[model samples]
Target chain A: MRGKDVRLEDVVMRFGSFTAVQQTNLTINAGEFFSILGPSGCGKTTILRMVSGFIDPSEGRVLIGGEQMNGIGPAKRPTALIFQNLALFPLMSNWENVAFGLEARGVAKAKRRDRAYELMALVGLQGHEEKTPNELSGGQKQRVAIARALAVEPAVLLLDEPLSALDLKLRQYMRAELKEIQRKTGVTFIFITHDQGEALTMSDRIAVMKAGVVEQVDTVDNLYAHPRTPFVATFVGENNVLEGKISHIQDGFAIVETQQGAIRGINQDKATIGDKAMVFVRPERTKLLNGAALDNTFEVDFERRDLEGAFVNLFFKSDTGSIIVHEANLGQHKELEGRAKIGFNASDAIVMRSGELSDE
Target chain B: MNSLIRSYGKGLTGIFVTLTAFWLLLLIILPQAFMLDQSLWSIDKDDQLGMKIDRAYSDLGLLEYDAQQATGDTNPAVQEKIDTLKEEIATLEAQETDPPREYGLQNYTRMSSLHFSIFVKSIFYALAVTVLAFAVCYPVAFTIAKLATPQRAALLMLGLIIPYAINELLRVYAWLMILDYQGVINSLLAWMGVVSFADKTWIPFLEYPGSVFVALIYAYVLFMIFPIYNTVETLDKNQLEAAQDLGGSVFLTHWRVVLPHAKPGIAVGCIMTFMLSVGSYSVPQIMTRGKSGDWFSQLIYRQFFETQNWNVGAAYAFSLVLVCLAFILIMMKVFKVGIRDISK
Candidate 1:
């Protein structure tokens, strides 16, 4: 396709001896909203800056629209950066700000003014041209900054934590607004943030970064349902680990030895004997069924139960370990606190090698 | 009452203002009254009579009586001399009756003829100096406020303050050494073959009151530059970038964005520069050797000290003060902000 596709091949960035973003490789298809998600100081913004041409990759190269960005400066590159603070010019009228790029290109003033009006209307800011940046509310200013960046019509729009400054309510509201804008513009959006929920909610694909390296890059569903690494499992969504070693294997099940007992799990990989492994079970996937049939059950006393809007986070304080059992909508089960027995079926568990994830 | 004192202790503004007025009246007004009284009286530089003496001479009538009595002793020559002495005595005795009633509008009118012109000239000089200083200082001020690094910024600031701290005469004289025909600049030029050692090379430097403008402006330019610089410094750098990003060229950006922001400082600088330059006689005197460069101050100085006319001098000084006041008033109206705002 002629549309822009981003490719980062073996990219490494370092500050002094501290390597931030090391030998990372990822390719994003055109029109996909890819998010680089991590905790603070995980080198997510650094990667975004490199893609936007604000920063040069210390090693390797970045390709957009199948062209190598060797000598392209930020202005010349077909990329626009939205700063964390939004970086809206405070002194200009909203209309003038959007028309800035066209003015630079020696377009007639009337034509540029009209273009600004059109973009403002598209971003739901039609009647607010005469107002300065400070006069507009935070969300409005954000939309204006977006309009100004889009005025150039760049191939890839780089967002560096644009929603981090907003309050939680506003942040949630802008998430939908940003998605709508992305769809309307039809531009490749490369968003960088530290919020996992935000990434999962809006991104077509999510790349989890840790200590400057991309741990995994995949669709959010794949990341949530089947995490290849424990870091991804822990970061993408909450998944509990039951430490064990493969005791025996069967046709569709494997028994893993642990302090609780030899637990049965669906053997997805058919792990070898005496191979140290972990049984990864989602909190919701666990059933505390007292009256149903179960292949495996743990004789554990209950620690506590937390009731959220639609589910409960059940903490099981056991000698093996404190494992969380998330029960979705515990209706008519108010007496199951203080101490209880929990049971689950073999189909609910997936076993893995103990060292499948690095200590990072 | 104790609580009242406690509450109003820091709120002593009204009391402080009253005290200030008392001091101002006691010191400023009383001294000004004495000066005004002195300005009315003419001083005798010739010292024909004692300073306190107001009585006319009696020898004036005695000379005439002697001349009439001397038929044998006094010859035609003695008579002629006596007649001359009598005329002088009568003139002095007649002055005693009127007591040199040269008061009121006469002194104020005398200012109109000679010293008044100097007042007008001083105001003009000050205005020219303000305009000239603005042209020379704006670029330097802009550079210091916008571009200089912290250390270099300090140095640029020192560049302004160092020259200002020097006595204005010395500051002006410093320029004289550089601009003079045989001084440092000419000597350097002579080595460069631009002009010979024997050639009078300061011909261009004298063109259009160059020495006067240079010395006067250079001596006081910091006064103008700092005020403008102060205003421009806090100006948001983002504003300039925004203007450019909004399609303004360099000149348009300065006009539409930067100049309006710096208006208050410009007004303050203009007022201060104009006030100082018009009243300054030393810089122009030293730089131009007090000859061809005689501005209005020279005339006022001559009127008060040389010609012994205090009335005309006061009138001239007053007129110049009034002119500056009028200009400041006009400026305040144009800027539409209080003086205190710009001063800060």
Candidate 2:
């Protein structure tokens, strides 16, 4: 079955007096794997529920396949949802669980059972049609949930952190598996997750949300390389933030004066001179100076070092705040200690107008 | 036993074991055993024993008078007759005081056709009450368990339980007041010009067996609802949404998901309701007020109190116990739930 586009036009959701989602317009193209990435309680799940027809937006309309979805319930809509806990009916056999949608539609038992078997096989779960959900492992239950959602031939499939319950390895594995299934089925998948890594790994485009507002929506690479907001820059990945005023502005870069000294970075937000700004640089991009000249440099006393498997995080402390410099874990830096100079090129850093930074 | 000792030490363990054993024997086993023994025997009452004793006393008095009137040689003969008569009176008195007991199953076998019909009717009525109670209580239980907000659910539960704080007989009497000839419903009907109090043209609700059924269901509604509420409360809300998301209607969702999950509770509720209604004496007695025929429990009561025959009462009571046991087994089978699940 082919996928269809989903569009939320000026949609807003409010519960009682509390607004869960701000007014927003978004268009998800057909057959694209889109992800809404945010921290917990950021209204991403609210959006998923609205799209799945569980809750109607308090304002505006939700459209699927160019048809208005106002006042339509989840069952009548062309979307299916996979809950976070993978709510598989424990009393039913695996095949029966997969065929529940067909049964609801009044399909004959034998035909539905055959279709269930086919769908189960599609998820690589053959020869286990009669096994109950409790008899299977966690991942198998996950597959059964997916097959159940697919049985309805929905144009859009909405998943709300379905991998959050698995262990790290299984979660990483399921990311690729989900991506592959989305590719083969060519269904518009709207995945909601708080894990930026999962979104980056699986999504064609990612929408970063914060406090009931959509911060930015772009491709995975663009969202990471050129985040429009300070929240997105720090939330999408780790960043070293320096708050200061824009002292100078050039063609496309700005110099910010801070307690750590003057630092120049790309002015993505186009901050004017004398405006408050924050400079953000990835830890991996910052390097040990070792007398090499760079556009921006600072001297800091080494505070601590953490050894990761493939990378080493060297934490340095200035009078202002701590700055982490990430490097590959080579044997050269095994004996390094004390004060050191670290630097990064101006093009590697970004400058935006001062705004809220992520607390975590 | 070992675990008890390990948990509570030897002294408390001994007390616990002894108390449990005492409860088992005194509260459960001994009473049943006594009923069984009583049911097994009937007294052989000879209706002529009192007359025979009176006759023997009169004969002794006459023989005494004859002895007093006879001469020396004739007096000895008369004295011997008097002695024999006295002995006969003593034997007749003893027989009158303590009759012979015939041990057999005659009490069970000698049930009259009318009483047996009442027994069957009682069973059938109890079954109906069970089904109707389930139909009424299942939706209420599910709403309270899964639909209502927490405070509203608590309020609903409190409302259900508040009536039970009063005595059961009082509650049944309250139903009597509501359904009596000139009671609440009929009075309201009379005021509405549907029926007239002056002409005595009021509906007789107590005359129908349904009145007793309604009272029985109202009396034991909690027995049916609480178990189901408990089971349904534990169901995850996500499962419901998942079914709806899969296009399952409300009926299908409950039929396939909620009902299956609540099998044990439903079985328990049916068993409790059936047993309570079948053995209910006061509810039918109060609700019907002698307008309808006697229930099996009322028949058993009459056999003991009015008929003054404990043996037949025990037999009828034991029969009811057997029927309840069979019903429990049937419910367990139909619901596909084990005893362990019910206890939970």
Candidate 3:
């Protein structure tokens, strides 16, 4: 099946008095694996539902393949959805579950059976045609759900946290599997997930949402390196947030004066002098400098170190707040305790106007 | 037994076991066994036994009179005649005290063609009521279970159960009033100029079998709704949306997903509705009130109370039980559910 681009133009969703998704504009290109990443209740699933034709947007429009989709039920839409729980027909055999869409399309029983087996084999479930969904393992059931959705030849597939139920290892495995399937089918996949790791691993582009608003949408690398908002900076990955006000702005950089000291960072949001702002720096970007002159530096009391297999999370107490520095496990920096000197470059630190931070 | 003792101690376990056994013997096993035994046996009462007993009483009186008339004479012939009459009276009394019981299927086989037809008709009508009740209840059950908001579902449940607060017979009688010759529907029709009670031309709804069906369905509709509702309520809502998203029509979704998941509930509902309707006496008795033909339950009642033939009544009642048991089995098979599933 060929993929089709899905576009949402000035779409807004409201439930009674509560706004689920505020005015949003998005375009997911054909054959692209796009993910909407957010915390729970951020309206990512609401956006997915609107695109899948389960519900119409309260304002503006949703278009698929440049055709307006208004008043079309899910069954009549050129999209399919894989629910968070997989939602495989438990009483039906694996093949029957996969073939349900074909059956609905009035295909003959024999033809549906063949097509079901073919799709099952595509999902690597060739020998499990007659077993019911309960007889299969969690990952196998997930594949069956995917195969079932694909059987309809939908131009776009919407997945709502389909991997949230699987164990970590299985979840990681399914991420690659899903990416492979998307590539093979060339169907535009809009995956909604609260897990940033899953989105970073599987998505070609990710949209980070917060409080019914799209905070940032970009490639995973750009999202991590140049997050446009403090929420995105903290939500996508761990960051050391230093509260401060802009001391001055010059040369595409803002100098923020905090309780500890004045720190310089790239002015990502172009803050003016005396404006309330925060500087965000990735933990890995901080280095154990021995009083060396850098754009930003601080003296901190070493608290403890947490060894995470390939990396060590070193936390320190600064005059202002607790700071974390991520160090690669290179058989060094093991005797850190009591006191230390840390520093980072201006470009590695991002300064933005103060806004909502993610939940700690 | 060991687990019970381990869990509750010997004293409580002993009490529990004893009470359970007592209940089984007294309330369940003994009554059924006795009814079955009564159904299998009938007493062979000689038609002339009453006549012979009367004649023997008169003969004894005459013999006594003769013996008294003999007076002071020691007549051996009179004494011998009195002794012979006394002996004959003793034997007749013994015969009256105990009539021989013959055990066979005669009680069941002796049902007349008309009664047999009534039995068959009752089963078929009950089946029809069950089917119609299912058709009516499934939508209501689904709406309450899946479609309605929680408050709306609660309101609908209250509406369904409020009528049952009254006695079952009272509810049937209420239907009787609603469908009577000059009852609510007829009065409305009269107002609409379809018929007039003033001209003695009201519709005879009570005479039609449909009246019995309506009452029976109303009485047992909950049996069908609750079970199906319970099962449908447990079905994950996501499955429905998933089916829809996969391009399945509403009919296809229910046929493939919802119906299969509700098999056990549907089977249980059908069994309960069929059993209740097939043996329903009040619904037909009150609705028809002798204006229409009797149900099999009514015939069984007639055999016992009207004809004073307990054996035949037991036989007919047992037949109904067997038919219901057969229906339960058939429903289980048709729904592809087992006894364990049905109990759920």
User: What are the lDDT scores of the predictions, listed in order?
Assistant: 0.76, 0.93, 0.91
Native contact fraction, candidates in order: 0.11, 0.87, 0.96
Interface RMSD for every prediction, one decimal?
Answer: 4.5, 0.4, 0.7
Query: For model 3, how does the per-residue alpha-carbon lDDT over A1-360 read when each residue is reduced to its tens digit?
Result: 999999999999999999999999999999999999999999999999999888899998999999999788899999999999888888889999989999999999999999999999999998999999999999999999999999999999999999999999999999999999999999999999998889998999999999899988899889988999989999988999888889888899999998768999999887899999999999999888966667788788999988998999999998777899998888777887777888899989999999999994
- For model 2, the interface Cα RMSD in angstroms equals 0.4
Say what the interface RMSD of candidate 1 is: 4.5
**Runs in model 2 with CA error above 4 Å?**
B47-98
Mind giving the per-residue lDDT tens digits that candidate 1 earns over B232-298? Answer: 8988764554444334567766765677778788888888888888877787676667546467777
The per-prediction CA RMSD against the true structure, in angstroms, equals 6.6, 1.9, 2.2
Q: Would you list the clashing residue pairs of candidate 2?
A: none
Ranking by DockQ: 2, 3, 1
The lowest-lDDT stretch of 10 consecutive residues in candidate 1 chain A is: A351-360
lDDT assessment of candidate 1:
0.76
TM-score on alpha carbons, each prediction: 0.72, 0.96, 0.96
